[model samples]
Target: MTEDTLRSVNPATGELLAEWPIDDEASVTATVERARVVASFWRELGFDGRKQALLRWASYLVRNTDELTELIHKENGKPAEDAYLELMLVLEHIDWAAKNAKRALAPKRVSPGPFMANHEAVVEHPPLGVVGVIGPWNYPIYTPTGSVAYALAAGNTVVFKPSEYTTSIGVWYARSFALANPQLPGGILTAVTGFGATGAALVTSGVDKIAFTGSTPTGKRIMAAAAETLTPVLLECGGKDAAIVAHDADVSAAADAIAWAAMANSGQTCVGTERVYVDETVYDRFLAELKSKLDNLKPGSGADASYGPMTMPKQIDLVREHIADALERGGRALVGGLESVGDRFIGPVVLIDTPEDSRAVTEETFGPTLTVRKVKSVDEAVELTNASEFGLASTVFSKSHGMEIGRRLRVGATSINAPLSFGAISALPFGGTGASGIGRIHGEEGLREFTRTHSFARQRFAIPGMALLSFGRKASTVAVIRRVIGLKHGRHS
Candidate 1:
């Protein structure tokens, strides 16, 4: 491929799927500037019009499911079923955003304080002119769509930059909107392709808001760069999510869920289970069940494979490094070990009794690996789980105290009795804190992420005696206001 073009290759077999000319700063800037003009047309469409356009795009995606799924598989190195599931999530967010954006961003009336009773106060959420979205290679369709769909529904035009690894998938996702809604203008949704440079250009392209999903280090860099222009950003970054199995947990169910969660999509999921903290009372039972679930699974590029090859080839080294570090630090592998980490496909690797300070335990593996630690009690499990720097999302398994345990975790979203359940629900907002990342995507929080809040206060009628806001206010008004404040607020004193 030429230096100015991107080569979309399959990680499993080194097959070249497609090639496209990449975007640089000049092209990305032009796209964003054009989107700024189109933003006016899209915003003027209002909620109802925007909803129709969004729903139509959803319909197109649904109708072309096979095509989209195949592209996702080819470009993302995910199995067909997993790619379909990812596309399913994209549709869910699109449908939800199309239907709920109005209510989420609708104007609302607020009660004026006693002193300003003559004025009517209202709060309105208007779309920021345009949004720039930078997506990740993992979960290519679903992750970025969380922002693209909601931003479009919220009446903002979007300029999306799919990861260089999955440029084809990103381009297809953006092109779908225009194909589905030819009745609308073209610049409402568009994509720019390339490596990090293209994404960097979008951040400084003067878009109203920037929505990004990627690694923590990259997310921080984007935030810092965007800060130069004082641009607002919605970042969905890294996660080393933990799954806690309490003494009262359903051992078999927890094992079954965690196995699938920790290995799905080659464990590249941002919210996947990377760490497991199990109460000692149930540790043996849970380990046995988990081993059975992970034993037969294998990675391949076929329809019947458990998952598929690692999408990013470089990620395999990190996975191996983490496993080697754990093994060298006195940890024993209960399942596959460093030997199972292939050049492109990594089998399931489960480490037990690893040092808490080990990189595998403290950092994000982003592979089909899990670190299991036995804790003295549920409280100890929570403590160890919360010790990690990443706090994106987590899972809790307990028959009786699941909710209680989940509430105590420092993560953004937690699933009880299930792994990664919060992600499937469209209404729940998804995000993280601390090193995990900033802002949110999905739900009302996501729709508002691309908007600006405006409060309007109109004078309905003037109280003749109280000219408080006028230049001709009487001294009696000040005296009356002081008396009212004393009567209302001083009574408790």
Candidate 2:
């Protein structure tokens, strides 16, 4: 591909908005090497300096909100309003990281065991040198910043590779930060652009750690590539997340949350609600309310529309195939039929009474499509929810037993009466187990994720005969040690 000729085509109007050169392998390697050099300086600056720099970056984001949001909309094919929301959430994460980095990464005095009482023990989180981040296109700012901001605040220089589909937005993010903090080292936050090969190169590069957010297959590939260098990695992969509605749940409220979770950002969200399990008692009522809420949703490539075109064109066929499989397998379209899908935008698609084994129920149809199934009870709902390979995120909508059901579902974070809103809290650890990927970002866990713990101990006083070379009464010393342990921790006979 011609690097300089690369352009970001607006999915809305099929117009070329901007173009930039694709950073080649040599450029990527040089950037990472420079980051490693700068990381030494960034790490030595201590938490205060790093936190202030992050805060300044957050302020810059807020000040340039309009310009950034418009760029995001043009590049990602999301509504300008939704793009703004993504940017705002990213800023929130930056603010939180700056305020909490010291406490989260500071050393603490740990208790020494009785045998080592004369020594003082301390454990501290230290930076892991340069970090490589391979970000996704959806929620371009929020998703990547979850790793990038936290990594930076933890004192690790970052080399970020934004999704090839949204490279312009990524460039815009890095450029703005550089403009805001010109005093920082140039490589403190560097941006590279390319396809899978570029991302693969990043993973195998000499970075101490790699953080990736993408599909399950790509996540596996990243893990394999990281293994070549035995480098540590954090993978935030795909999810077939579900929302469970209990008998006592408020049907109208559940409907609203479900619609937003399944359709937001054109249903391109990693933690978006794709499957919904409703108690048979309120199944009919819940379906009615959900359909009514989705009735007025308009999906198109325009400013006034609720959602815009799919950022990735290939996803449209997948959406169509999933809907077709569900209908072919006796699934009923409660609100939107197959005709709802457009050339670029997919209108709201709500599948009701979908069979548990159908593609719509089992696979992740990352579109404005939701599969609703009626279950006998909350136990059944939980069972069906946990059956999927993905356990990224889920929701429980119940007035009396919201927390109860939320705990039963196997996922990273479960929201009560909400839809994937747990991600909004920077104090909460995000990421999933199982096929959803490993490790976490955000909160105190995020700060530690980018660091390695080092333990130090220093003897305050020297005791005679403690060293093996010292000449002493060894039999008497052993007897005294045994007696002391027996008097202190021996079980009563």
Off by over 4 Å in 2: 1-5, 466-473
- TM-score for every candidate vs. truth? 0.99, 0.97
| Per-residue alpha-carbon lDDT of candidate 1 for residues 1-493, written as tens digits (9 for 90 to 100) | 7889899898898999889888989999999988988888999998999989988998999999999999888888899998899988888999999999999899999998888889999999998888999999999889998899999999899999999899999999999999998888789999999999889999998998899999889988999999998999888888999999998899999999999999999999999999999988889999999999999999999878999899998899999999999999999999999899988999999999899999998888899999999999988888888898889999999889999998999989999998788899999999998889899899999888888999999989878889876899989889988998999999993
lDDT of 2: 0.89
Candidate 2, which ten residues in sequence have the lowest lDDT sum? 464-473
The digit string of per-residue lDDT tens for model 2 on 156-232 reads 99999998789889988977777889898788998988888788888877899999999999999889888988999
Please name the candidate that would achieve the greatest lDDT relative to the true structure: 1
lDDT, model 2, position 137: 88
Candidate 2 to native Cα RMSD, angstroms: 1.7
lDDT of every model, 2 decimals? 0.91, 0.89
TM-score of 1: 0.99
